[model samples]
Target: MAFSETVKHEIMVKSARHCCVCHRSKGLNIEVHHITPKGQGGDDSADNAIALCFDHHADAGHYFAGHPKGSKLSPAELKKHKESWFSLVSQHKIENPKIASVEISIMNKDYPGFFSPVFIRETTIYTDRNSMRKMFEFMGKNPDSYVEEFKARFPQNDIYGKHKMSKIKTYDDLMEYFNGDMEKEDREKPNTDPQPHKFELSPFMREYKVINKSNCVLYLKLTNGDKDVLEDYKLYLNFENVIEADSVTKRSKFFDDYKYSYNVFFPENNRGEFIPARPVLVQNDSVTLDAICFRPDPKAKFVNLNWELFARGVFGSGTIRINIKSSFEQHIRERHVEPSEIKPKFIRILPKWNFE
Candidate 1:
């Protein structure tokens, strides 16, 4: 009788919520069952009671394997059961709503880049469509700010994998799936070839060469193959706003290979393998749980070329390589690249191990 109005409303909401186990709406027919019997010491509070259908309430006492027939539970047992029911309801509600997460990575050569993966823990309440629209509109005003806000809210390990998302097997498939939800005007534009993701080194190709006149800096050059998909090689560099840079004239003759890739010549650390197409065991021991990885050699070359230019353009300056290799052909050559026009695969880039 001393319960506050807010507490009473919350208890009403709990009753109105669908039943935790049977998926049936509580509505007006739900009965508040005292988890702990009055004869027992169970408190007359919302936590000690749960809304359940008549049939479910009866079945609960008999369904479990260890539950006794006609064996009534004590007040303490009922209270414990009610608490368990609340936890179940919370988990179900959280997973059924929209959720978002963020991932961050460091740009690397052999790998796509070093990034941290973050997940969303619970469902965010938007109250109404207007509230959601306002947030989306706010996000549209400044993408960078929106991205920052997103990263901040969904910080590293902020959420855990409580539910699974629809997995995207390939990039193209993922885009086409999203295209279904776009406006008519947005979809009308000719779908240009896949563009390098903003974080990729397509636009800002890192070039590496020994400058004799003033040997100061070092970098590597990235090239596109002679293929339709190669046209999508234009990428955004993660280095931020780099207004301009200098190019090194010196060239090496070691780049004569059938294929070309963005290689991180000196990968400081292994942030795991990039786009590994299933790990082939190089070595296995029955006694020990350690093994070596033998990933696909997709970067293996078929033809050799002059080493003057890695693929095209001068070193140091940003450049896009265009070798024009058909995506289909690339797929036939290797299944690893089959799923997508641009399969993010890993490569070994040690200065000493020249592809030539």
Candidate 2:
């Protein structure tokens, strides 16, 4: 029988990755020894195993083979060492500990593209003192002032849906909950209460003019109108009725071949670099995205371009809509009209046309 990885990890965490007898970190040589020798009817349980360094495994004074007669540590003494070490580790963890980040994907079953979204959030295992107290209280333990101090420093949000709080008995259990493997209800469900955080899109101008007949630029300002600061909010942009033109023909004869080509840029820098449509952080009362550049095929005629912006945060989510009218003012030489006519007939036309 061998100790499972899960049990081994739990023991290691509780022991602070050190030998129970000598209090030495196992750099390259760590062994899990059975307190009651396996030969003497010991099962491979966590309570029956103790982590030891190479020196402590063979130390004559603490652990020895064949029942040495002189001052050797009994199984009872090893159990005491394991208990004391785990307590020390737990106390140190309550004082100062590293936190784990968990990312959960939330999707609206009705709206796949618009509603399905994933958010990366840090867990409250290390920072939420009140949560720890709640766990202890659930276990019938009296919580001390340390829990209050933790609650003051790191506040917990109600955005997380109802969780099985009583199941969390230790810090490891709290981490396991965030890792998404617990036998609990849906984790992505929003709270029953409405969140106060709000987001809005503010267009810089109502209309934009196309430059060089083929290129145009527009700006939309994203503002976090919420009272509370929104952390790690993401912005997404969608464009419609835009297509890419072929370099060889300079235009596509078929309408299906034409696609939208555009770029987004930060107005402050304007380095001519295109910002990929990725998630961006929007602080409370701060503007996130400043500008967007729209470039269409040179051969395109008058077309109405549609733009949609979506935003999601810990508190709430919303969408904004924008429309841009693109019309070409330049005229190209006519091939059907005779050169000798008093004036060649001029008409608004798109270089690319589909013959039906």
Candidate 3:
């Protein structure tokens, strides 16, 4: 991950848009360089940032000890220059915030110069037997894609090799296979609930696809609102009153079972609107499927997901709130043997940041 917009903006102001190396105002023709390279265990923090004119930045960036170069900028030198320039800027704070500003380069990006201390990206989903049936029905048209997506969501049961999946095409046959597999797992790890999992599917799928033991299953989004491509980005999640992120088997943990998620979701490729979430590629200024299934504190009216987006050129923290206390309780009440009764849906997919 790289310096966040917050830190970069601060560095730009502290240096008064001047490259600390040359000590001359270069406006937006400057790049913030890390005093100590990230490879050397440096972090994307304000203290590690130094503004350098594009020309000096190129020079300071390239250094080979094997071929001793002229005036190679060292970490110590960068710190000294940054401190000296910051002191000078403080002595003479520019009256105009925009004059000789480094952020002019990003002006067209409509960069939100300041971000909220906490960003709340919230959503809710409601599921019951009918929703499950609808989910499967939606997936019936293309069982092959379902199998691949199902594998991504539940790798443990994806034991059916691709070569064999083509043989099992119908939705009913797929469910039967899953139910049998569920029994297989039950035979290994006996469950106190219904012996065969009458939901018409396997225990593995039930555990993840249906939020039977969790408050709700949701799809979260990771957005690169900036035009810059966020390279080597990692999205980390901290689940409060959420389940642990350990896998019982060698297979990767399922959505509801995972606390540490690095997977991406692509709805377009799969019948995403009707199926569960899973995937992993990203681009600049676009949105993709990227989130969750959880066994949360059901009693808590709202479960808060503390998330950190770490990527080169960007980083920040935010919370995705899933208000579930009432909906979950209602679901528990409606979870009876009746197809006519509808389950209360809490599909709180955030409108502000969803892929249309």
Candidate 4:
């Protein structure tokens, strides 16, 4: 076998190793991958390869298709992936092979300078999971103003689900305990356990409307005792709608799971002007849209649309809309309505511009 001596050595080592993602034992059928696609200026050197179990290899291929952090694959990890690939090929007893024929497929095309590496400047926060839970339990019951103060003091630390802490019974209840001066010798400091909260509830209610022939709108309203306040809110329209089967994209594409509402719009589109789209929460009430508008494509017959939700904590609900109209129809009837129960995150009533 006339394999590159360097490649041969790498294969020998990784074939005896374990899979990276799952850390499971690497049995046969493992595959190799180039973390950065060769088509996107990646060299075919061992520094860019990685050995993955068959499933991980497929996942790596999919992630590499448009992976933003293409240049950051570590040399060691790359070597492992390469070794796995070579080991498989060698086991098949394939004779000496030509390298140039290896037309590595490259997906995800972005223009030059479109994406750069992500620089994660690290700071000391709640590295301990126990402390993280205590922090969220502390944040849950505190007033919004107090939470903001805590955030400013500990900007790097998250006090909520971002840290995976769900044991907190109440943000205020936690705050009461934390603020109480129990001496270091006090027996009732706080319970440091990972037991998840039995019934985790979000104080905020994200509301939205899904019109049959119109786009959806979102409302993020926070409940504080008897008063309702709107926190800093914005609407986000995802390429993949996670709400219903009618979505153009699949659920796996959606990154957020706990999200309630998908998109939120306000003031209706009939006015023919761009509303700022941000809504102010009315005290003691949930943010609701007055009306929703649709952009009718004059040349199209119909339009399909769906929504996703984004929130600080839990999301609301989502929905889809199919607007049908004829080209000859002018001044189409206004359509779109709010969804029930599920409050989505970012909500927007999209415009199709024309009917098919």
Best by TM-score: 3
TM-score of each: 0.20, 0.26, 0.30, 0.21
lDDT of each model, Cα atoms only? 0.30, 0.43, 0.48, 0.34
Error of 1 at 108 (Å): 77
Better of 2 and 3 by lDDT: 3
Q: In angstroms, give how far residue 160 of model 4 lies from its true place.
A: 68
User: Over the stretch 1-356, how does candidate 1's per-residue lDDT look in tens digits?
Assistant: 33333443344354334454464764434556655545445456766566566665675443333445645444455555556656665666522211111112212334322111111122222122233335656767533344344444645422322121122233332232233321333333421111111122224575333211101122322232222112111112212111111221111234434122322111111111121122121212111111111111123211111111111111111222212111111111112122233433433221111111
Residue-wise C-alpha lDDT for candidate 4, range 1-356, written one tens digit per residue: 23343543354244433354554545334454566666565555556655567767665554443457664444445556455555655575323211111110112234231112111122221122234345555878434344455545764443332432222234443343343311224433322111111123235543332223222222122222223333333333322221211111111122345232323322222211111245444344433322222333333343333232222221222323333342221222211111242233332322322211
Worst 10 residues of 1 by lDDT: 285-294
Of 1 and 3, which scores higher on TM-score? Answer: 3
Give the residue spans of candidate 4 off by over 4 A.
Answer: 1-71, 74-230, 237-284, 288-293, 298-301, 329-356
118-169: candidate 2 lDDT, tens digit per residue: 1112222223324555677797866554333433454452134334444445
Model 2 reaches what TM-score against the true structure?
Answer: 0.26
For TM-score, candidate 1 versus 2, the one ahead is 2
The local distance difference test score of model 3 is: 0.48
Worst 10 residues of 4 by lDDT: 97-106
Per-candidate RMSD vs. true structure? Answer: 29.7, 34.1, 19.9, 26.4
